[model samples]
Target: MRLARTLRFDQSDENVFERAAQPDEWAVSGAFEFSNWSEDDLSGKRRQAFANGWLGLESFGRATFVATAKIEEQEYRALVERLAAHFVEAWGAPDLETARPVAEKELAFMAGLCDEHEPNTLLIVERSLVTSGVSESFRAIAPQEATLDLVAVHVTSDD
Candidate 1:
């Protein structure tokens, strides 16, 4: 199945996020984290995260970008289990049994987001507070040719 994983082009995320997700960690939209929050609740790094960060499933950290990638069934199930536990611990869900379905739905939505995008296409999420709740829109950045090769392979001598 296709899913999204954290992607980092530079170290700027370290300064922008409270905790920056390591590259390649699984990611989700994470809008649920702000379900009970308001404008006042977001400040500084927290606000940055709400603005344009993808939630890393493993670290509970934030990433500026995520790339569509493939995931196996076993890894997916483990992610479900981890997120279910997080719901219980972080959101006060009754238990894993109750949280499991909700966690699955979140991951399923994330997977669906990746369905149309090709593998390695980077995605960014922009979130805002709507009257009823949070609103999110996604933007996709297509991959480019390996430009790094020019710097690595073609060095010119000084004139």
Candidate 2:
């Protein structure tokens, strides 16, 4: 069964940077710094800064994954759009409509392959480095009808 896993912007703690540095097999690639949040114009803009920061980080991660993973471009772009929506939902944006243009542009680099399949599980990790806050969330969805099996097997078997 095909599944789509998306890491939406849920929340994060201050230790996000530290946690991101750890070796995670699930991670698609190494961490990279996001610089869009360094705008001097947003000094007193707390809410805007927070929103930009979240989106910036999410985009950074998504870009890394799209470049590294051998998935279809359309699938990656859709995932990016979903991520932007997730960011707006979590941060409470003043104008979600305006944000879509920027999100689309950000995802424009991915433009090909429309038959990519989604993953079985999507993991979301958010962190506020400036405030030292962290939030981790995840969601699993099946694309089609399916059944999950739960079985317990003894680690040690007795003859």
Candidate 3:
């Protein structure tokens, strides 16, 4: 039977690096916030000055996950769409033979966003797996400084 589980970061007492290295064994899936940044604007410059921070699942096996900020609502929506496509292309039915398309699409989508909001986002990437007699699970990683919280729910066949 498959089982689902959720783990909440003990905000009162936990470190991000340590958590990243070794999350709770019982946790199958989880999410958390990371970091932040700020910068001053320069009137004379042609570009806007900005700074930001982020935290999320870094690497899952050979795949590396990354996320950035979204300045406008339109951009945010586009980002979500792109992310979905990325997942589909990277690990969906009828999988592509190459990862180039997924990478290109993701980069192009990101290029359209504002630089100021790029650093303050979360990204998750993982490899595909199959389960039969065992159970299925999900895992999420995030930074502690991001100030975001996640609530995970576990599911089981008996439940």
Best by lDDT: 1
Worst 10 residues of 3 by lDDT: 46-55
For residues 38-82, write the lDDT of model 2, one tens digit per residue: 334234333222322222233222210111124455655565566
* TM-score for each candidate, following the candidate numbering: 0.91, 0.30, 0.20
Q: What TM-score number comes out for model 1?
A: 0.91
lDDT score, candidate 3: 0.28
Give a tens-digit lDDT track for model 3, residues 1-159. Answer: 111111223431132222221221111111111112112221221011111111122221111223343335564344334444444554452443343454344434334332323342333323222232212222234334533335556678999
Error of 2 at 154 (Å): 30
Q: Compare candidates 1 and 3 on lDDT and give the better one.
A: 1
Tell me the lDDT of model 3 at 137: 26
lDDT ranking, high to low: 1, 2, 3
Give every collision pair in model 1. Answer: none
Regions of candidate 1 where Cα sits further than 4 Å from its true position = 145-159
